[model samples]
Target: MSTFEQKILSTIETNQLMGSDQSAVIAVSGGPDSICLLHALCNLYDKLTATCVYIDHHLRPDESALEAKVVETHCLKRSIGFMSITVDVPAEAEATGDSIEACARRLRYNALEQVRSDVGADIIAVGHTADDQVEELLLRLIRGSGLKGLSGMGFKRGRVIRPLLEISRQEVLAYLDTHGHEFCHDSSNESVRFLRNRIRLELLPVLEQRFNPAIRSTILNTVNILKQEEEFISAESDRFYRSLVRECTNEKDPAGHHSISFATESLTTIPAALRRRLFERACWETGCRPDFQHIDTIDKLLAKPVSGTELHLPDGVRVVRQHDSLLFTKLTEDQGPRESVAYTIEIGQEIEGSGSYVIPVLNRQLDIWLSDSDPRDAQLMRIDRDTITFPILLRSTAPGDRFTPLGGPGSKKVARFLGDRKIPHHLRHLHPVLESDAAIICVLGLEIDERCRITETTTQQLHIRWVKP
Candidate 1:
């Protein structure tokens, strides 16, 4: 076996990119790197099965057909399976407002995944050399990426594996020449319009000659160090997310949206680095493509006393502060305003006896009963039955509402009262308030009126409990 084939086999073994007797879908673009990978894998037919998939991004209408034929002919000569697909990247880019490069990459990977599934393959292999890795590191660095992005591409991500990650472009070209194999050159690679092409053709050569002859190796070393550190941070981030963040289901539109919540108070306890990673993970889980500006904005939001503040981000994501918690939600097209709609709690004759009333608006249930003794639960509120007249009025808070909390000095506006308790501004108006004979009784889940508190001479005890879903 040649040195290139030995390196390929070694990389596969070291990274465990694929197991013996497994099937792989190879992404072949008829380029030197891809053709090299396909030829090497075909030579290892004893270890695994390989299928070639050529995806035409429709960017080069004149050249794409010929490239597909080249790859197909090579696969046929090697007695390997081959598939061809065409994706309209331009249409997708226009529809999603993404750059042509970004859209093409997205569609290419998606097409490869679909092909892998259709072929019942275990993994999808792509030819990404060490040169590509160096370029990627520079690209992400120029684009202002974090540790994870700076770490560059991995040998294996999900079902996609890059067996040529350790090989150089020079090595790939040498191997193709030795084997006397022909490959197509993409005209786009020579265009300086794309940042990657410019970096490859201009920046890389200049850096190698003018700055350091070993710039590629230096960048690869930096990527290796960053990848190790990022792995440790990623593991810690996962631990913190599992322990601190929680997924919240919207009962009204459970299938339409995705949401995640974490306590705002916990932000102070976490390191800034981990916090940013946590935010990114939360955004990704909720279907948002997080960026540096969005994350920085969220960090600033945490430092301010901006309860109920909200930020609408890309991909229809909405981030809001609700009292003590920060919520990340992927909003659907039909998702209406997040402001809580005003609702009234109608207490029927059930309030006079033991019964439960569902508060659909708040996704909570209120339980009331005339008790002979205290429930002793902190969540249960004990009231003096004789102190207030029934035909109790339960409704959302209104302006000018006032209540004297139990053991409090005097009455205060309901708005200020809730504010003091750190209730979110948007939810202050939606907070449930109980009234008896035009006298404010209590704010559920907060404090009860001092006038309605159970006393030593109280004859009847009224119990109120709030249950949340």
Candidate 2:
């Protein structure tokens, strides 16, 4: 059997990588590794039904087009379905601030997955090889990574598969050349500026030449051994997490924010390793994830177990130890508070829009002939033409999140005021807070804009009302 044929068949049987009954999409970049991968899959096309996807990142427009044409021609000559997608490279690279290598990798994978889903392919194959695996292992060590990072990439990730990961780049090139197929050369692959590039060009070569000739084989062998250890550790971590965490909600309200209950004793009982996992999961659940150091600090604090101690972590993630368990929240730097939300009445315009200012016409002012007498006697705040702040702040409400009263002429915390007024607990979270600079204007219908009370200069009026829906 040919060398490539043996490798392909072995990978399929050993890894349970592919089944003849299924279809796949190969992400071919017109490079040797990808071309060899596509070529190998083509041998099984009759049984497996595969297509080729070429992602044309518009970096070097001419080069990209040429590469796409190469892949298209190859696929077409073999009667395999081929497609090319173009994405703006420079804009995306700049937006993400990724190095050329990083940007290209991100765009390439995203485009490939999109194409995979679009084509209804059960598997998507990539072209990583043994040399790439060793380089990655070295890179992960130098960058200070945990066990998960050190474990390297999986042979199968979600719907994506790496068929050539066990082979070397030289073997792939030899296979392609032996079959008389040409492939594009990626110039950036030779650069040594990036750390991975440095490892690939500098360290890997020296290790092979001077000390260990089987470094690539050794790396693969270690990964093969660790795969089972990694899987076992993962299952233990998950089991501990599931047994401890329980979600509680008092019926999800408008904002979709709900209450959850947990035990500190239960959380602390988990092994230290499992505690870290729980902390990370908790942060993600609360729309944030505390950084590594913050997680470590929270884990340490869990030992002594105190309540109400808040730790502000990177990225605005805050954790509060309440009783035994911890609660995660978004932190806000103390800034000058908004004074008030105010607006003037337009002659006959709707006051409803995205702004802090309220210019609602009172129910008393509307003609029974022109408007229905709203059952709720919620009086709309009126103002003169001079009082409105253009483009005011209209936004969602907060917990322990409050507003200042307009007619009452004082600031009241939202939670306390709502509870005192007996506003339905479910409806309070949906209440919109209108603000200008320092104080709250109106709790929509529950209160009025303080600085914008009906004044002597008020000239125009219309009927306006707030409804809970």
For candidate 1, what is the TM-score? Answer: 0.69
TM-score of each: 0.69, 0.65
Candidate 1 clash pair list: none
- Give me the candidate number with maximum TM-score: 1
Q: Give the CA lDDT, 0 to 100, for residue 141 in model 1.
A: 88
Please report, in order, the local distance difference test score of every candidate based on alpha carbons: 0.80, 0.64
Give the lDDT of residue 89 in candidate 2.
70
Which regions in candidate 1 have their CA more than 4 angstroms from the true location?
246-256, 332-469
